[model samples]
Target: MASIFSRIVAGEIPSYKVAEDDRHYAFLDISPVAAGHTLVIPKREVDYIFDLSDEEYADLQLFAKKVAGAIKKAVPCKRVGVAVMGLEVPHAHIHLVPINREADMNFFGEHLSMQPEEMASMAASIAAAME
Candidate 1:
């Protein structure tokens, strides 16, 4: 069975797309810790981060760095925090979270919910910033 991340990449599941390249895809988290929490995943579905090839691993980080830059520009934050806890989904992924305080990146912290329209708008802004 394909993981949810694969489904999103395949367009079987819709996402608030932030940016994409031939090898990776980036989009906003529906259950975000902050206003601009985003997820970046490889196009090829691997169950663990360490399972990716050396080139794949390097490329993923490079792609994530670009997305994080866009997130910082689109959303107000002191820095963009990066996390790799490969337990939620059965696919290799990274979290790029916008944070002003250290506590903002708390994995166990409460998540924020925005309406569909708000999410769509935020995604557009982030995507634009990536350009």
Candidate 2:
């Protein structure tokens, strides 16, 4: 069975897309920790981060770095925090979170339940801010 990330990559699931290249896809997280929070994933679905090939891992980070920069510009934050807690989804992914403080990246804390329209608007803002 395809994981949810795979489904999103395949267009079986809809996402508030932020950016994408031939190698990777980025989209807004429905349960975002902050307004500009985004998830970056490889187009090829691998179950674990370490399971990815060397080039795949490198590309993922490079792709995320670009997205994080965009998040920083789009959202009011001290810095963009990167996290690779791969337990939530079966596919390899990275969380690029906007943080004004150290606590902003705390995944265990209460998350904001943003509406879809709000997510779309946030994604548009982030995409425009990408370097």
Candidate 3:
């Protein structure tokens, strides 16, 4: 069965996309710890990050850097933190979170609630900044 991330990549599940390349995909995290929280993942659907090949891992990281920059530009933050907690979903993914404090990146922190329109607007802003 396809993981949810794969489903999103395949267009079976809707996502507020931030950026994507031929080998990777990035989109907003609906249950975000902070505004502009995004998830970056390989399109190949590996179960773990280390399971990716050397080249694929490098490419995914590079792709994530681009998306992180865009998220920073579109959202106010002290820095964009990276986290890889590959347990929530079966697929490998990086969490790019905008933070002003360490707690802002806490995996157990309270998540923000945003309206669909707000998420869509934020996604557009981040996507534009990626250019």
Per-residue C-alpha lDDT of model 3 across residues 48-114, encoded as one tens digit per residue: 9999999999999999999999999999998999999958799999999999988898778678999
Deviating ranges (above 4 Å) for candidate 1: none
- Model 2 CA lDDT for position 66: 92
Per-residue C-alpha lDDT of model 2 across residues 52-101, encoded as one tens digit per residue: 99988998999999998888888888998888996878999999998878
- TM-score for all models, in order of appearance: 0.98, 0.96, 0.98
What are the lDDT figures for the candidates, one per model?
0.95, 0.90, 0.94
State the displacement of the C-alpha of residue 23, model 1, in Å, after optimal TM-score superposition.
0.8
Go through the candidates in order and give the clash count of each. Answer: 0, 0, 0
Whole-model alpha-carbon lDDT for candidate 3: 0.94
Task: lDDT for model 1, please.
Answer: 0.95
TM-score of 3: 0.98
Q: Model 3: how far is 78 from its true place, Å?
A: 1.2
